[model samples]
Target: MKKLKQIVNEVKDRIAEQTPPAQLTDLLWQLICYPPKMPLRLQQEQFLNQAETFSVTVHDEYFTKKDLQINGFKWGNGKRRVLITHGWGSKAADFTELIAALQENPNLEIITFDAPANGSSDGELSNFLLFVEAAKAIIQKTGAPHVVIGHSFGAMANVVALNDLHITPSLLVSLTPFILLKENFIKSMTTVGVPADAQEAFLQDFERKYSIPASYFNMPDLYKFDDKLNHWLAYDEHDMMLPYSYLKEFLEAHPTIRSRNYDNVGHERIIKSAQVINNVVEEVNKAIAN
Candidate 1:
């Protein structure tokens, strides 16, 4: 008997061979925009159950071009509001440890929400653009926060949202962020077994549909908005998703931005590190103080 994995691959190959290029292009878009949704784990649910839950609507003029509602949670009734955004394919409840650490601040009203197509959000597909829209909508509803904490693509999306909305938090804590959208997309294409020609076609379709070049989403383009914004960047030396060198150039360019390096931790594990949590807490305190 053929292994289940082998069968799946054979089916995918058959689909690719039989499907028309236009049809295949649409499928490629779906593949990139929609990642498998991860349900909240038992511990995550337990943690979120203790907080006040609600929903907010994200509005956009293109693509979805409609109001999409996403679920959110608020912890504490403190004066300072802090917003937290989770990474791609990740749900809001994944920040349990960070939430616990931030809860130490009596005056901090921390907020976290599931992005579109993630967790309890009402969607089947999502991209960085959608994530940015969601973040902007939440910020608008919650008002300006004291700090914005984001993990991986979540961090990049939040930065883009802040730039577009002209909202600047006192501090932005970015964990394992990537600067080049093109590089990320290339990696995604390779992971999904997209051929080189199909990759080009995908980019063309993306640009045509969005009316914006895919390259415009790069870190340099997004960060052009606010040079005055304070940043607290933390990344692991061993992070496989985003190489250390990609960020080193940006860090060196902006010496004022505070950064911390984790010795043994990788991308996802760094979030659960107590030391990382402590560093984040310290920055939150500093932001609140200022």
Candidate 2:
């Protein structure tokens, strides 16, 4: 894998040298938007097979606002709805343990979906804006949930979608959220040996395509909640995908957002932690009770 990455970087360098600036940026944009298809693991397969499945048709702004069908799962038929969203490259079944734990509550109707290009959804490419649209569609279909829980990139999308839709749930839980979209994209491009000039050009092209600056996606500027909303943020200190410093900086700026940090759960493992699942269930139980 290491050797492969080195070869890929070398090829990227050669492309930068050979291709015109516009073509290079366009290629990079395409590469970044398309997520690799991951095979369903045993656990994910088992969870999906056991759950009730449904499909939602949503218009994706990333694809010129074209309509696409997204797959979703439901675990309960309770009055209080709780929506769960998975991270990038992750399917709804990835929340197997968490959803199983949450299902113990008969009063809660737990729901989740696969974003476009992920899981059983129909697409070859996806972006954060598409995720926001999917969330909105599911929320509209199921009615506003009492609690919305999001993991990693899904967490960021939930924040933006809830704010944009003006649907303030009683509780919002963000687990290991990826907060810096623009900064992280640049860092990823740099790691892949994309030239700094080409990176800048790609950002400009992205802005033109999206009709908004990528900086607008950053959590600090995008996060908004009403007084009635209760927000909970949980993250791991040793998250390898997202540095703790980013969460720290975000918390420091917005001191009032409720947050907690764990020691060894890391990024992905945090989702399967018994402690994390229990806390999330407890929060949801509390919300519905009130």
Candidate 3:
């Protein structure tokens, strides 16, 4: 029994010492396979990390949910308020640059939140609904007419809130949004243990884990062809998660949505770029005026 224990300990030590497998290649393949979803998730995470270091900075603070104190930053008593959300795994800080840019106008109030478990916000990692709830909280606390913009997962959260849950953003902007490619997402969800032919089990597990309906994965078709989307601030020339073909299809399905695509830009850079900041400010001004 003693020798058996020794062997087990050695095995565990070796397992711990060995280098972990590289998830990068696997992640890339997943992007290639899904074309859009996984890439959106990855970009959001990286964007948030950048915000923590060098990218856009937000009015970041930790606040109590019970009273919503220590809420994020604000400047200029601008009549038009804007609530911005970061992509998946992103913090409010990711939109710092945009916040700064828009704040310069002196006619706009900027609000941003660390989606649950992000930035200084306190919450469970699995509470995906926190994204939408936080956005609403920002608007209510500020008490201003607001336009809401989100990147990637934040965009999806906006959709669920506006379309599925019925919370309206005076003006809504979704960047590099994920609207479909359900099967690939389900494949990733398998890590939690759903098997083939067990779609119901997957939905239940998803709801329990993230509080999101599986129908989010089974979203309706909404893409229209547009070479202009390739110009979006968030597209990589070499490695694109969702190529132009996909965006064209997505826009076609949702023509009522207003959007602009910039040239040869990838999602994260677009979020952090000066040009995008200007573009957002321009649009927010228009939204407020109209």
Candidate 4:
């Protein structure tokens, strides 16, 4: 983490000192796309280490189209399937609590994979496109997931993937998801000290690489909740990483979507809540029962 901070500081200093606007913009674009390499946290490490003791089928695959090697783990033999993933810079083990809750259920078959540049996946950089492609690859391999749950960037990307892939998972759960890429880009720019004049250039370079216009990187455009699908959104009002306020208008407009609010837990911690685990289990059981 210290090294990551130093790298970010050095990038900011370079961005501040660069002579040409184009050069500064290019530097900022690289910073925005690069995820700082971080070792697993203590809990993440313990969870993963413990998971290895179980009878889990693990495989490493080089996704030919994406040019990256991805790792996947499959557990249980039930016919019902659930595909789960974590957010940017987060490993699949972030779902430890939920995984534990559902692991005992003999009726479930759980699938999890680390996205490129996250967890054990092999990549130096990743973006929304990479995330969507990873999800599509997993869905293709596992068949349509009856339930799909994702956190933060993972949640947002799943929305886009499910839509683009024409998949209608019976139950969809999104936790602390950003509504659009523009907000995410703005946050990155502010955090990295991209000068006002260089913002447009940075965005242009990004769009050129990703082929996604800023105007189209939005929640509404990426996902539309079908009436047949059960949609759930869990958010923490105090979440500093992703403000729950982003969903205010969207939630009001979508009356059918079930939402749960937590008071003390912040963005990442919400996943560890016992209440959250219970609620998700109950919801999945209901979906399964019906």
Candidate 5:
């Protein structure tokens, strides 16, 4: 935490040093698009070290059309497949517990990959579209899985990917998702002390680069692409990363969507919860059975 503060201070200093408006916008844009390379915590490191003991197969360089190579993992040989996607700055190994729990089902195949610029994947930068494309590539390669699971940003990415690819899974589990990308980006910029003018400039540049309107990054609008889609949404009221109001508004609008509100578990820890894992496995089992 101290190191992160130091880095943030350094960035703020650099921003303060820039005299030109264009330079400041460019710098902020670069910082926003690039995922920070965070060192693995002790538990994450230990998980990776003993990953082989979990009896999963590793694909060192799974190819995508954009020539990006993603590190992929597979468990079980069953015909019923499940794909799990991790959030930004998180790797597939982070899902070790969930993967292990799912392994209890002998008739299931689980697939997960490290998105480009994350984990063992090869890249220095990534964006929302890149995440969507990576998920599409994996689904295209493995075929549509029975159940699709995503956490945070990955949850939003999977929704976009499934709609674009015209591949619908039997079940989709979205864990603590950000409903609006533009809002999230602006919030991050404000947290890092980016000026409001610079934030606006970054948003304009982002839309120009992606060739999509900032409003199009909304999850509820994307969900409209397939209204019949079965969604299992899980969120915590006190998640520090995402305000509960955003989700509460979404649920109020779409009361038919299945959801579970957890207490106490914040953003990241929600994925690691044993209860959440069990619920996920049960949902997957039920989805596959049908």
Candidate 6:
């Protein structure tokens, strides 16, 4: 009787652990704590809906962090290729202005697609691993030398992917990457409504290994990163989501990463903000020049 009860309890525990990503998404939406009437423009899609005026479509390809393929179009024929990756819950269209800005330079070939779950892309439940694979596959497909600009979750994934997957690029620009806040993540998750037990288990798995399967801060070779990686992060000091202090470690330790700090740009706004767009262009140009 005692053994049976113990087994039952363990099964219950395991079952409780596997919650839906949507629950976490909802909790995160609630936890946003930002008092903006509407930080995200309500075009319907996760920023992808806003870019419909431009010629874009679903990328039809099998994608993982190491392998990404999509039925997408390229805007320019320039020799220099620049790929833009959107943050979590965002689609390929998020880089509209960034792509336009790069196109003006005449040296850039702009390529972008919806990350797995965000846009018209084929998959669901996108996380670090899938993003990294998609980015790697996209880079390989381009053939030409490239620079990668990743925002938020995408940014963190690219850093690890470049290191782990060996998808080296001419330059890497990261905006609002989230990877070091071990504890605050729980608070962030709580705001999103993740059950207490699920969040705990996720963190336990994340921390059990030196390089958690997670996208952020899992670089076993941070020491090897050179000067070509530039990180552009926008954090409203009062922003409720992330701690800029802990985020600084990625910038400080790596000899190669250069960063820009914005005061009230907040999280979502900075990815496509005019200043961020401009900064990203400048960074890419600098790398191309080098």
Highest lDDT model number = 2
- The root-mean-square deviation over C-alpha atoms between each candidate and the true structure, in angstroms, is 3.3, 2.7, 10.9, 3.7, 4.2, 9.2
Displacement of the residue 220 alpha carbon in candidate 6, Å: 8.1
lDDT of 4 by residue, 44-88 (tens): 677666542221221223222436767777767788898887887
lDDT of 5 by residue, 1-290 (tens): 34345556766986788645456665665566666666677876676564332212223231233466776777788889899999987888889889889988989988888887787777766777778878887887778888899999999999889888887888999999978888888888799887787778778876786688677888778775445777899999898888888888887778777999899888998899999999988889898888
Q: Write the per-residue lDDT of candidate 1 for residues 1-290, one digit (tens) a residue.
A: 13323433643684578655555676666666765665678899899999998888876444477777899899999999999999987888889999999999899999999998788887767888889889988888888888999999899998888888887788999999868887788787677576767778878888998898788887866785446778999998878888888888878877777898998788887789999999999989988988
Compared with the true structure, model 2 gives a TM-score of 0.91
Model 2 bad stretches (over 4 Å): 1-20
- Candidate 5 C-alpha RMSD relative to the actual structure: 4.2
Task: Summing lDDT over every window of 10 consecutive residues in candidate 3, give the lowest-scoring window.
Answer: 30-39
Candidate 4 local Cα displacement, residue 261, angstroms: 1.1
lDDT of the structure predicted as candidate 4: 0.76
Q: Give the lDDT ranking, best first.
A: 2, 1, 5, 4, 6, 3
Go through the candidates in order and give the clash count of each.
Answer: 0, 0, 21, 0, 0, 10
lDDT tens digits, residue span 28-68, model 2: 76556766556789878987888888888978767546789
Residue pairs that clash (backbone atoms under 3 angstroms), model 4: none
- Count of backbone collisions within predicted model 4: 0
RMSD of 1: 3.3
Model 2, position 107: C-alpha lDDT score:
91
lDDT of 6 at 90: 71
Model 3 has an lDDT value of 0.51
| Tens digits of lDDT, candidate 3, 139-192 | 556664457777876766655554443445456666676555454355453433
lDDT of each: 0.82, 0.84, 0.51, 0.76, 0.79, 0.57
